[model samples]
Target chain A: MTTMKDIAKVLGLNESTVSRALNNHPYVRPETREKVMEAARRMNYRPNTLARSLATSRSYVVGLVISNIANLFFAEVTKGIEEVADAHGYSVILCDTGRNPAKELKYLDLLARRQVDGIIFMSGRLPAHVVAAIKQQSCPVVTISRDGTRHGIPTVRINNRAEAAKATRYLINLGHRRIGFISGQLDDAESGLPRLEGYRAALEESGIEFDPAIVQEGDFRMESGMRACARIMQAAPRPTAIFAANDEMAIGAMKTLSQLGFKVPADVAVIGFDDTAFATVVTPPLTTIAQPLRMLGTSAMEMLLKLMAGQRLAEIETVLECQLVVRASCGGTGL
Target chain B: MTTMKDIAKVLGLNESTVSRALNNHPYVRPETREKVMEAARRMNYRPNTLARSLATSRSYVVGLVISNIANLFFAEVTKGIEEVADAHGYSVILCDTGRNPAKELKYLDLLARRQVDGIIFMSGRLPAHVVAAIKQQSCPVVTISRDGTRHGIPTVRINNRAEAAKATRYLINLGHRRIGFISGQLDDAESGLPRLEGYRAALEESGIEFDPAIVQEGDFRMESGMRACARIMQAAPRPTAIFAANDEMAIGAMKTLSQLGFKVPADVAVIGFDDTAFATVVTPPLTTIAQPLRMLGTSAMEMLLKLMAGQRLAEIETVLECQLVVRASCGGTGL
Candidate 1:
């Protein structure tokens, strides 16, 4: 690592003179500054950002705590966050929790110790201890999940309940009376419960009975979706339509349906949420609720940047819209 | 944000004494250390790792420069890296380049400025300037891509040529004589060209004539795959099977084949590489070569750790095995 001292030695100047020249301080002559810059560039001397951050009180790094790395949806969000952060001259510390509480807390503590400028919490639910940890940090924290705004933290997300209701209503309009629902972790008030409530509300509006037996719980994973589909299939008279909270589970349900010799949209229709890349690649091309995944990430990062700059947030929660992406899986024309 | 001075004030002790006690200096009494620890905890004071790193010369951070974040294959690799890094008490700085040369260079400089302890370069091909940048860095760098080892940098990856040959052989054994090949970025010596060479080698070994007309170049993206597949299909008599450099392309090829009214494994069998999650979820599934994506990440990180610890690597390049995962897409039984 080339340092100011190394440049000074090469130029036969005082280290402080080299530092002033590099920082473009008025005390240093322009010719000397030019000479110092040339030498620094030739020696590949990178400014020590970590040490400089101590004086500036700005690390220019944001910690993104994602719940799972395997879930492809987060990948899009991460992309959006990286683009915004990079344009702002910020680097991201990716802390994948993989839904482990211990790992999540450890990463939060690590970020605190490292003194990151801010954090973007992108997880399903915010635990109390995690909230406490965020509160303890003097740095601003913005969340790209559903529940964070409840704690008064700036949040960026879509209205899961309304989007889910739209999906259910779309299915209802397609003339499906009995619809099986695959709910995410039911305890996740920000994610699962609200979506479930939306499904129920849509059913009530359509004058269709909401049957608990036809609804199965999934962990928002493919395997859980497969298992839930199997369970839902066992319900007497089997629902003609299924709406999964997310695309992964919906694909899992479709896989199970395929194995059972059922044709999608003919024997059983399927709908999914979060129109991730998988939605388009699936056999029938899944009809899903397309949440502004990348926008959510960019919006959260922008809000965090504002908060970090000590600016007041015009809106505490930025709720992006979700659109129904109609495809073959739901027996609908592309929409 | 609590500082040692705050803890000292709370405990009615000198700040220097509190610092020494917190550091557990041998000169400090055990009782005084305990009192300082309790006070620090009560005040929620976190020892600034940035300042501590300046003294220790260890950032406890590793920079992972990925070419693309949207590629699901890298997600598994990141998960593996994160798990190992977390266990080693190191944080990961995720630098996504999005395949832009300027962005890649910028991130490399950022990692250098931040003084990351080491770096894991994950990209298709290592450009000459990137190699130069790595060489100039004081910290160790291990690449998880193909060509980094050519510059004598430690690398961890599957032998692209050999793995592609295996995929080609699998298809050959299934009685496909006219096999169309969809290559990745052809200039990527570490990724694209080697895989293309492998396909040629497999054809030669099987005494099957390699026809140039059926081979099309792709950029390793789904759109490229679709375009390449369409081009390849324009060949006279149409190749009976297609082998894509990666799964995304393979899925795209399948999509194109379906649009052309061709039945997979019946009209035109399709195989892919890097059996990603999409391989299984796609209709009819996909038969492809499965690289130990996660293990590659773990291996590169572990090797970088060794290099950072000043240990000599027994092997300059660690080559993992790639297996053929046979499924419905190729009309083949499980391997």
Candidate 2:
């Protein structure tokens, strides 16, 4: 509770001198600063951070909006973001939108009002106009795991199309002539469109006709995938292999296939994206496309910090690669 | 950027009247309040949250100090906290200490500086003195998954000892006499001592002699379980059953034992605490104790909010029960 006045009275110096010393103003003598610091530490003095923030216009805090913390993918990415943010003396305010855009917008408003230095948007489908309004507030906003290039916001993401294509090609090379695709909800902004496009491109390149009947839309939930798989299986001459946009969906599909008396790989091979923790634990394991999730988070934080410091970012889009981890689910080996 | 002065000028009123009306003060006429609100909205006026915070001393934000988000148990618990916090119009700032008390202290300092209205400490070994120091700052601190009753801070946690005893008793009823125990990190505030105590209590009730050599310490990690399982396996008259404090350790032990050519339930039975997602997916499907993780999160937030509202809190502890989920891992019929 010690203020500048108390320090000044104790040191027999004017309040202005005490304030300058405490603020580390260059005008204050080094000797004065040393005496003031020693006295402050001795008295167990703590500065009024709220009052200081009002004057400095900096809270040294960043806002991170994620869909769900329980999702291992998001958790890993958050770890990456935390490391980068903490190293720079910045803390993150976490807002879980629960995949609700309205909630995401509400948090955005709250973060803006709180005057966060920057924001890292991870997952969730935030409306374009809402993002624009945030940018208009003059705070740096970096979008992660989603391509926000059209909005001109700095974005860090994986090459979803390329990774999807690679996964599809791998399936094709395994002698699967007919392939079914399970797509995530198109409204998810980052997950659905590019991956679906990649799936199409792979089929086109291989001289195979794109069959709309074989593709089912899923909301990225396990239940959605379960139902989608059931529908795909009921289709005439069901595809020999299935590619899900994410591991959760792929696992759901695998579970459904198992219940329906289909032997994975021997009957219908399965592959998933995101290489989440469940990717390895599911029966027959799972072959997955691994997004550099941690790197994506790290890059997002780094880019946001750079922008906050008034540095020009080299590119609006930062893309990392994905790896294909082949396991038993793709008709490979043990769990 | 429109301020009260701008609104006042447009409304032909004093800044004080505009401010009062905008704040919805009862003294202001309802008509005036409506006019002020309409003008503010039309002008896209956003209040300076930092300045308002300085005056009101309420940031409408809470701080969450967690050990790690990658742990599925913690992640689920966090999700519950988010649900309640968001509903109550409070944002949560997340600080992951990565199980380091020094880092936890640093984050506590940061949270204090940020002026979060309250804090929820989740599964971290924070010294009591640290909790006292935090409480001294006049911020409501609620420790979840850790005992903070003596520190006068509200706590929300499952009855770990009772849950552990139940899990052990279940194994005992299954005709297993020789059971090995894997203890979580001793430093981990919750889950360690209480779980071990519960394990011992169950053995005592069954009139079984406590075997110190059969107990192994694990850091609540899968790799640690693997090492501990190896050590236990080499013991004279190896245990026919193993109980891990958590699912990760249980799965690790199962994987190691299986690799060593032991058939689960037939050669060695395993049970884990915290029925995480992996518990069901792993081969032999782990039978474990299930904590109401999400409810714990919600209750913690509610308690913190109540404390922040100046309500006199009743006894600072809120203990929930845990359920024992039977699965193939515990030598139970999958049916």
Candidate 3:
């Protein structure tokens, strides 16, 4: 390890003086600071990277753009990203967009201004202009759980279609033919459309007709989920089980069900995606499709690192698998 | 709104070349980079703060040291801080300590290295060495929710004693005399001690003697709360109500109560602190002591900003109030 002490000794300066110079303290003469910077660079001191990055163009920092910081899903994902990032001598700046597209764009620009080496956008709405801006800067960007609409940008996400189909099949095998679906916004290309496709595919294969009447489009929020639950339950033929697109919506639906005097699994079985921490805590617990959220984050950060290193990509998109965690909300495995 | 183009015109250089010089590209002669830095300083361009900081020592970045970013409490608090920080032209790097004391120390050092203008540390177990290190740096740090054990540093937090007493008394007024208390780790100074005193004070005021058997030590986590509930329920004379130190523990206790064939309010009324989102979503909807969590963050950030701006403080500490949210879990007030 080439420490600052080595640089200081070589320049016949005190350690504090070398540190002050390297730190760009205003009190240090500009020429002295430049001399310390040059000597530190020659000594290959890692701490001098503050000045070294000027020549190397590496900040050794990455920005993680998350849709909602309050969501447990993002927290677990961040833990995974930090685990990998720490091992590589990088620190993460978590930029929470709070699910606002405009805020997302603003945070992206802010990160760019800060000169983060790369950015990993985790599960959020990305406007076209934001993509274009990212392209204009030629930034190293990777989209996680949400695909980047920008052509050829790498993405790390789960097989939403396959997973949704599997979750629906589990409900069907549990003797639920009248299954309702709580979907994300229809316009959400990454999760909504594909998840709906999988649900329909499973129903079609099971000889159960897909009924739009039982499908309620939720804005992927709790209140929306609660409203959708009420709508689906009042249909001409009520659903035996409800499959929610995400955990928040599912939890919300369950809350509404309980409020309406319906017992989970007995009166209305429910399942959700994401398998957030709340899934296990909610009454009866939730049986749902579990995305490998942590892995998704790690994979995205790894991809972004590769991009930052200018490594030739073998896979532009990496799709991981999802799991079906059985709990009391689905009324057990005995069909 | 100074632009690099203006600086380019002044120096008679190409736009990209001027950008390169300003960004300290090694290709540019050191003298040219210095000239561009000097010009950027003269023009007062905002983004040029990267180089400007070398002269003025202002990174315009604040670091938030949180115990657990995964918790909803921290998320809401961070939003408050960000709102204030953005208004002051500062960006925050949310450092999630993740409840690991060593990681907290590491992140503190990392923020120091990053040259953050100030830091706001939220509740967590702060090791003595870490506090000592923070004191040594002479950094502008304002403890939020957490208090500064290091002398004379500013702190902004809630009246834990007052709030906890109010929550306990609410349960008492609901005609519950044998109330169980779930407390945080005794050694954890920020939340544990003050909260316990309030609970005891409330019990004493009602002439209900405190029983050691009815009190359980929890680590302000859900698992501990669940276990504490079990232990409290198994007592010779089980309590009619339970007051948890934090929301996580309260929710955990409720889950356990349900599993043990007990009904909230009907069998065992429960109250919690922090009023997190879970307080509403949980079965029966927990009645809780609602801290002004957002204001706590904003207030601390504001104090930190004042400290960073070299402003004199009339009051070194600010204590906010808490509210009691009545919900289904506590039953009706007339009980």
For lDDT, the strongest prediction is 1
lDDT of model 2 at residue A69? Answer: 89
lDDT of 3 at B77: 85
Better of 2 and 3 by TM-score: 2
lDDT of 2 by residue, A1-335 (tens): 56778888999999888888888899988999999988888876767666777788887888898888888888889888988999998888888888788877777888877788899887565476666666776589998876577778889988888999999988988877789999998775577988999999999999988888889999777778888999999888889999999988898898789789998889999999998788876667789999887888899999999999999998988988999999987775322
lDDT tens readout by residue for model 1, B87-180: 7988999888887777778787889889899999886467788888888888999888658778998889889999999989888888889999
lDDT of 3 by residue, B1-335 (tens): 46688888888877777788866678998887887888888975546335445446678888888876667788778778877887787878767667778877877777777777898887465567877767755469888866673466688888888888999888888898999999998887778988999999999999999999989999988999999999999997889999999998999999999999999989999899998778877778888989898898889989988999999777989999888889878787734
Error of 3 at B116 (Å): 1.4
Residue A255 Cα positional deviation in candidate 3, in Å, after optimal superposition: 2.0
Better of 1 and 3 by DockQ: 1
Worst window of 10 by summed lDDT in candidate 2 chain B: B123-132
TM-score of 1: 0.92
Question: Clash pairs of candidate 3?
Answer: none
Q: Say which candidate scores most in DockQ.
A: 1
Note the chain A TM-score of all models in turn: 0.91, 0.90, 0.84
Put down candidate 3 lDDT per residue, A191-270, tens digits, no spaces: 99888999999999999999999999998788999999999888887888999999889988998898888999898999
Off by over 4 Å in 3: A1-49, B1-49
Candidate 2 residue A143 C-alpha distance from true site, Å: 1.4
lDDT of 2 by residue, B35-118 (tens): 989999999887777788778888888888888877788889889988899898788888888988888878777777777899
> Where does model 2 exceed 4 Å of error?
A126-129, A174-178, A186-189, A208-215, A227-241, A257-269, A331-335, B128-132, B174-178, B186-189, B208-215, B230-241, B257-269, B283-285, B327-335
Candidate lDDT values, in order = 0.89, 0.85, 0.82
DockQ for every prediction shown:
0.74, 0.60, 0.33
